[model samples]
Target: MKSIGSKWMVVLFVAVGVFMLFNGRAQAAYPEKPITLMVPFEAGGGVDGFARALASRMEKDLGVPVVVSNEKGSGGRRGSIALFKSAPDGYTIGFPHIATLIYDDTLGETKSPVDYSKYAVILRVDTATFFMYVDKKQPFKSVKDMKSAGQALKFASTGIGTPSWLIPSAVGSAAGFRTSFVSGHKNLAEAALAVARGDVVGGTGSYTHFRGVIDDVRPLVYMSDKKSYHLPDVPTIADLGFGKLSTLGVPWVIVGPPGTPEDKLEKLRGVLRKIIQQDEFKKWGLENGYEPDIMPPDVFWKKMGELKEVYLGLKPQMQEKK
Candidate 1:
């Protein structure tokens, strides 16, 4: 019996050694294959542009191709579902519409839109400076004009629950006017077109979206306390005494599927940190109206919680467009 026990101990030690050896090699050989980044919007839009810009540099550093996959629908619901269902390997990462994530997780009465458990946040990239742009042809030039007009205005929106809708709706309510949308356009450009072609009076979106149609639409107010350097001419929501609504902006975040290895998550965070710190990346974001902010997972999740509460408080007013 003593001889048998000694033989079993030797076999166990050998097995442990083999396991460690293979595990080390596996981790060292990470990213041997290409990575797919899922963008929950159509190609050639602001979100897609941001993803491509980062993916270009990520591909060079990671020594593998980084492909961007566009999965457009339902204000980022379709793509989010696909992303969460994807294997938790580090190769798959994506951007979920933050508003949709918050609404689906807490506010919505229906079943959860996506698997909350499978969502693992990597880091936050930046927040957009949202603006309400009025068409050049409209008599309304600023928030005051829209309010004083004392008439219902039609605007374009991505969807009902999205920032594209909620912010504008809330602003209108605050301004003492009823606002409705020719809503359901997929991206900023599409909604901006409705403004340019004079389909609707104007719509709200980030500076990048309106950049493509700058001449057709006039920026009225930025949804923040401070004016963007890129759009120095535009006033802030705070300038109109609505500073509390300023925190509402489209936050761009990067996320991997659930169960991403700790090593890979750390590596990704480090690599991405380096990328955000680059002067060129910063310049690109500035020019495009993205305030490039990088935060670790802990800080990112904390901010997410705070934002949920903010929106939750506004939910009642928004639902009724009060």
Candidate 2:
């Protein structure tokens, strides 16, 4: 009887030891080593630059080195899908354009077949104002003039569902102007160049993105109610008598895969909030012509939900291509 009891006790001890091992592993703190931040766009673009700058600062705040990895393809669907499939232990996160993640899900652009709601919201970093620009040789000086031209003007975009496309579509609807779209470009630089060379009449993009090329083109009007910092002299769409049609604010968000622990998510948000408030980060954003609009995790999530609704309402129009 004593020998039988000893065998049973050994088995029980081993089971307890194994259970503790896994429990400890599960409870282990996030970012035990270097963390990877995935950028869905190609390197050297505005979004990629923002990710790199923010990641550099976040590394200091988190006390861990943050590495940026580019996974470009399929209108940013490839990187986002990979992010979703990654382990939710907070080691991997994605900096995805809000429109691509929220609107594309409804449009069937992403192949991962996962819903946007599955991701954990971290923080909203900044929102940029978009501008419409035409070549200097164009006869139109303002949006009204451009509309009166009474011809379908060709426009270029980075791709469908990007801000480069949505801003133009929104302005076209509001201004009663027809635009022809040429897509499948690898980056915004190519789209901007296409507009400059008159391959297209104009293109819509952030004022910051066209800083160097502003001299080659004429700024028609900003899509937002407020004038852009980069183009303070330019009139807004509201200034052009299109106040009701003016709606332009694209948020840069940080998100982790779904199923991440609440505590871990909160930790990441807390660190990001601290980093965003830093004077250096704010200065960098201001210099780059971006508005620093930071929000708490919960508020950010609520705002995303609201924007999702807005995008859903515009789905029909967005689906219609020129």
Number of the top TM-score candidate: 1
lDDT by residue for model 2 (4-90), tens: 999999999999999999888866646678889998889987778888888898888788899999989877777888888789888
Report the Cα lDDT for residue 11, model 1: 100
Worst 10 residues of 2 by lDDT: 103-112
Over 4 Å off, model 2:
1-29, 105-112, 241-248, 315-322
Candidate 2 contains a number of clashing pairs equal to 0
TM-score of 2: 0.84
On lDDT, the leading prediction is 1
- How far is 213's C-alpha from truth in model 1 (Å)? 1.7
Q: How do the residues 258-280 of candidate 1 rate in per-residue lDDT, one tens digit apiece?
A: 78777887777778889999999
- Candidate 2: Cα lDDT at 55: 86
Give Cα distance to truth, residue 242, candidate 2, Å: 4.3
